[model samples]
Structures are given as C-alpha cells and as structure tokens.
Target: MTDVRSDDRPTESLRDRIATELGRARDRSVRLTEAVDDDDLVRQHSPIMSPLVWDLAHIGNQEELWLLRDVGGRTPVRQDIDELYDAFKHPRKDRPALPLLGPTEARRYVGTVRDKVFDLLDGVRFEGRRLVTDGFAFGMIAQHEQQHDETMLATHQLRAGPPVLSAPPPPPSVRPVGAEVLVPAGRFTMGTSTDPWALDNERPGHPVDLPAYVIDAAPVTNAAYLAFVDDGGYADPRWWSGPGWQHRSSAGLTAPMHWRRDGTGWGCTRFGRYAPLVPDEPVVHVGYHEAEAYAAWAGKRLPTEAEWEKAARWDPVSGRSRRYPWGDEDPTPEHANLGQRHLAPAPVGAYPAGASPLGVHQLIGDVWEWTASPFLGYPGFAAFPYREYSEVFFGSDYRVLRGGSFGTDPVACRGTFRNWDLPIRRQIFSGFRCARDARPDETA
Candidate 1:
C-alpha cells in the first residue's frame, strides 16, 4: 500500500482531492450531530431513523472497515462494536436499544480513526487493486458519510422540538420557466461507465431508447400541489392507484407530511418550525404514492427513470450525455441548491444556469424526483466489492428516485445517481414532476 510510482503528480492530485472531500464530509457530520443536545442525539427521533449518535459512530466504523482495515491493512480500532454498528444486523427501529456509545466517546473514536486514515493517505498506492484504484475506496467512504449526513438532516426535520438548523434561503426565480419542456424522441445513455466514483448500480452505461415525452420544466411546486389538495384529491379514488389509495387511507395522509390547515391557506412545519407554505418552492417530503396521485390528478404520469435521465443528462445537440444538467462540469452555487446550501427547495426556475440543453430547469437538485420505475440493475450489471450496496436492494418492492435534494451533497448527488425507498415513505426529502406522452405535433 505504501508503494508510490515514479511520476507522482497524478497520485498527489488524487490524494489531495480525497483528503479535501473526506474533510468536507466529516465537517458536515460534526455540525449536524453537534447542533442538538446529547439526549436528543441519543434519542430516536423517528423509528425509521437511527439515533444521531448511532449514525455518528457508524460513519466512523464504515471508514475504518473500508479505508483503514481493507485498504490500508490496519487493525480495527473498535472491533468489539463491529456488530453494533452493522446496519443490516440491526434495523433503525431497534438501534436505540443497543449499547450505543455516548456522544463524547463517539466523537473521540471517530477523531482517532480519522487521524489514522490521514496517515495512511500520505503514502498509499492508488493502483494494483480495484478497491484502491483511482482512490475509489476513499471516494466510497466519503460518499457514504455524506449520505448519512443527509439522513441526519432528515432526522432533524422529524424532531419535535424547535428548529436547530438554519441556512440562507435559496435564490429567487430570475427566469420564467414554462410549465413543461418537450424531449424529442431518441436514444440517450442512461447510466455511467466512466464516472470514477459511481457505485455498482449506475455502472456499464447503456443506451435507452425512449419515445417523445414532455416533462415538467422544474419539479412540481407547493402551489401546484396545493391545487390538488383544494380539489379534494385525497378523497377521490380515481387519482390514486389501488395500493396507493390503500396506503393513503391507512396512513391518513392528506396534504404533504408536516402540512396543516392554516385558515384558508396551508402551513408546513419545516425543522420543527411552523410557517406558511412557500408557494413557488418545489413540494417536498411527499412519497411516491402522493406524487403519483398528483400526476394522475393533473392528467399526467410520472416519468420513467430513463425519461428523467434523458431530460437531465442528454445533450440534444451533441448526441451524448453530460454529467449534469448544465454540462460535464461539477456543480457550483449558481447551478443548484445542494449540500444544504438552503434549508428547503428553491423556487421553481430558481437556477436558470442549471437548466438542461433542452431548457428543462432544476433537473439536478432541490428535491429528489420520483420515477415510474423499480430499483433494478442495468443490462450488464455486476456487483463490485460488495453486493449490499445496491445489488441486494434490487426488486419490485422499492421504487427509484432520481435527482438529488437540497440536503444532498454533490459527491453523492449526480445525474445518474440512483436513490430508492418504499413507496409509502414520507420522511425523506422526495418530490416529483409530472410527465406525459408528447402530442403528435409536439413530437415532430
């Protein structure tokens, strides 16, 4: 692992990038967990989420397992607690019952592990092994931590106390986006074979031919979704699928989660604070069932995963796919509202620079858009390093969601990144835009 090639410029650059990303992820984790009191960190905010303290230590344990132990060939720092943090071994609902480390202990443990990781980073080889090749292991660990950071942010939203998080509001809409944009009929690459840090599910980039379709220029907004509520969408059975209606009835879901009737208008509770709904911001915290009902009510349907990808990544002029809506470049503040830059979704058409080549706006961030597809691997899929990451989750039980949300980190949020969950989950920062088959004239 210590062997270094003669020409070290590329290796040095990779190391520097890995270090920076790892540090950024760790800083966010610290901030999220530190904002709340120790009791709150240890308490289970929701049965669907682990205690904040559990997540803090689990982040460290994963780094140790993948980076220090697997890549660097170092001894385990806390081998005794390996099973305690094993996510599969204990579900979120049962995590609080385990003998979890105190916040202080968890912090110290992660800090020590990080020190060892940096030491290993100073001289580790970035070749000769798939795990360490192109610094994939480091990148994987960083992405894992960022994913947890987003989960912790969701837990903050589920808390019953006062708001504990804050960020500047996302930029206001500067350009007027049409209701929808027409994606011309053609084939476009759906996934990635070249993204160095892409996980197993998004591998082996493949061509997906799709019919001409129209998708929302931006995600469905609170104002538009409110129309559905005002029309008594919840009481109507025609708008919802049989299973969707069943879940809706059982769960008592009316407006989006955290929303309540505030006189004639609606109010939403964000991070424990109640306020009037922002009419123009994309509707969030809705599940697949709710998004599906809204689309059906509006005489549209949810876009297939392929259609969503085509709208976001396909460059009509170049006949190729770009990494994001804007281009092959990484996201900037001007592009999208990501990495918790704002506490909520930006207003529709807020990021004009982030529009796709076909003029579809906000395709990369704000809220994770639900799709009309299940979580299945591509045609030539192969499990890499481990199957638990993506392979195990493949089936009809989980639905696919594309596009990252405002809380999502850039490292984990790309055009091809795949997120999945049960159709009834409302605690996640998810939303959807409507799509429909293009008219005969529009297809031409």
Candidate 2:
C-alpha cells in the first residue's frame, strides 16, 4: 500500500491511505457492473443509491470533482458535466432522460477518473487548506461506493441476475475473546470522534455524557439468533416495531435475508457462497428494521452511537485507532478475518483478537453491524459544499449501521464511525449485534 510519492511529511500517511482507498474503489467497481443487466442499470431506488448505470458515472464524476477539480485544481475530466451524469444535482425523475453513458462508455469514464485520482494524489499536499476534509471526502466516497457495490451484487440480481461471486466463503477463525465489562457513564464524549483517518463529519470531536451500561461481550450471531427463530419469534408481532411488524406482515420475513434451513441447522447464501451458517457467525445482511425486530424479540436493543462508541473507544496515544484491534499493524490471519483470498464473510467468533476491550468479538471486520442511530452530524455540524454527502440525508429516513464487513477493506472500519441505510435494505453487506441494559433490574 505504498503511495507513489514517498514524502517524509505527516501527509505521507494521508497519501498512503488515499492510495489504498482509491485502489479499493476501483476493485469494487468491477463487481458492480459484472452481475448487472444493461437495461436495469439506470433503475435507482434512492438518490443515495441511484440507478446502477447512472451510479457508475456519478461515482466517477464524484472523484474528479473533489480530488481533481477542487483539490488538485485540474480541468474537469469532462466539461459541460451536467449534460453527462452530474451527481452534484439530483436526477429529476420526471425530466426526460438525456442520452447517457452506455456501459462501455461509463466503464471508460470511471477508468479515466480513477487513473487521474491516483496520479494527482501521488504528488499533492493539502497544506494551509482543509486537508482533513479532503481526506474524508476521498475516504468516505471510496468506502461509500464499496457499500454500493454490495447492494449492486444483490439488487442487480433482482434487475436481471447477478453473477456467482467466485469468492469462496471465508475460513472460520479462532482467537481468544476480549473481556466483557460495563462502561460507567460519566462526562464522556458523544457525536463524531476523529482519528487521523476519519470522515469529515466525524471530526472536531465533542463531548456527550452517557449513563453507565453493559454492552455485549461479542456481536450477536447466527447461533444465538437461531434460538430466537427456533422460539417462533417472527410469528410474535409483539417483538417487532410497528413498521417492522407491517413490513414483516406484508413481506413475510420468517428468517434473516438469504438464510435457509439445512436439515435442522441454518446457513446463508451470500455472493454465491452457501456455507453452513456457523452458530457463532455474526448475523449479516439484515436491515435496520430487521435488526430492531430481532432486538425487540430478544428483549434487548441496538446500541446508540454514543453507547457504541463507549464500548469501542480507542487509545489515541497507543496508536491502536488505525484499524486492527491490536494496532496499525497489517492484519494477520490470526488478528482478524480480512483481506483473505476467500473474499467473503467468515464464521463469527473466529477472530478473538479483533474484539473490543469489552470482549465484543469481530467489531472491526467480518460484517457491518447495524446500530439504532441514524446518519447525522454532531452538534453544531456543518457540511462541505458539493454538499451531497451528509446534508442531503440529514434528518431523513436513513438508519445507522457500524463496523465493516468481509467485503470491506480492512482499513474501512473505524470505531465511532457511522454508516447509514434504509430500514429494509438487506441487499448490502450488513449485519447486527445485540446490547442491553447494564443492570439486571433494568433487563427486559
């Protein structure tokens, strides 16, 4: 993961991280289109998640706009951008469709922009200007699009049919679990917390005191969740939110998305892998509504962002914040189940070293955990222009999720980071863990 430029300055790391992020974006982009149909390409569900076809061009333009046009000060990849899939403004659903990039042309567009991003990143330095903002822009978009790639993998199947992801199911992991403990609430910081590698909204860390509570020693898993299903949990409307009950009643969600029974056991089919769902494997691909339903069923709840941060806090001085639970050291086969040849989710509880201090296993990778929070800025938050990132979605319908999944690059998950999605979106690389009241008296 060497940045082409080897500068001695601190920005060297920024350069390196960007290099990694951009490279990952390109890697996932291929997956986005591979399993999709040409006709279904422009079918967009939401603005944040646009038509698969239009989304490709939008992503390419995004990189050029921020990294090249704004930050690097280059002539845009294309002039008259509005005529050619501009993401800066929303696509009016009623507007007559203009001629758009075909799959071939759009692929070229992304390729052209990606090459420029890496080239420009090699030599640039964000000195007096807002380096942090620029860094987040690059990191967030790369991470953001990767999430989209996960969606395309499944949704494209609905549109046409998805390719069987050749990647095998990840190997099961084994490691010692971290300690489980309750956090005593004091005047602790809430809202977005910043590490050197944080999204813009996560910056300017501020404080929000919380109450003392106990969090899960490990994320909730397929094993534990099976017990819920085995108990006829879905049949009981009492366990579901009103919205969840409506959706489940209408859609008939008897089990987690992609889950199927294998004899008396359960397993999931993801990106073409049909392995037995390890009981300890973290439950994945469930939407916010689904996660909430499970929590209510279990008489527990999803952690608030503040509660999540309290459980997964890092020591800035120790430099452990960079990603791997132990530190910035590259992930080994032992510390976490990431960057492996398998290229898909492993069994949960496999990587004990990756656990949070409270013994929350697999907090950093394996799967993106759904939280009860929504995607919003901290108190007194302000978004940058080219404002689509946070502003468009603020106070909206999106629900927040955390951690990164197996499809995610190792660097993408950060403690206290936030990811948002709709309540019913089971197509992405998403999952859930459980939390509950600290006191036995408070337990539901």
Best candidate, lDDT? 1
Candidate 2's residue-wise lDDT over 1-444, tens digit each? 454455554577767767877776677777667655666566654333556776677678777777778778898877555455654444535212656677788889888988887888777765656643447557756766665565555454334244444666666655544424565656555444445556656655677666667667667778778888898988888888898889888988888887999997777775555677777667776777878877888778888877776666643344233333455465666666554235555675577666655455677667778888877778777775435667677675888777666655555556656777778887676777677767865433
**How high a TM-score does candidate 2 get?**
0.81
Q: Lowest summed-lDDT stretch of 10 residues in model 2?
A: 315-324
Return the TM-score for each candidate structure: 0.98, 0.81
* lDDT of residue 106 for candidate 1: 99
Question: What are the lDDT figures for the candidates, one per model?
Answer: 0.94, 0.67
Clash pairs detected, candidate 1: none
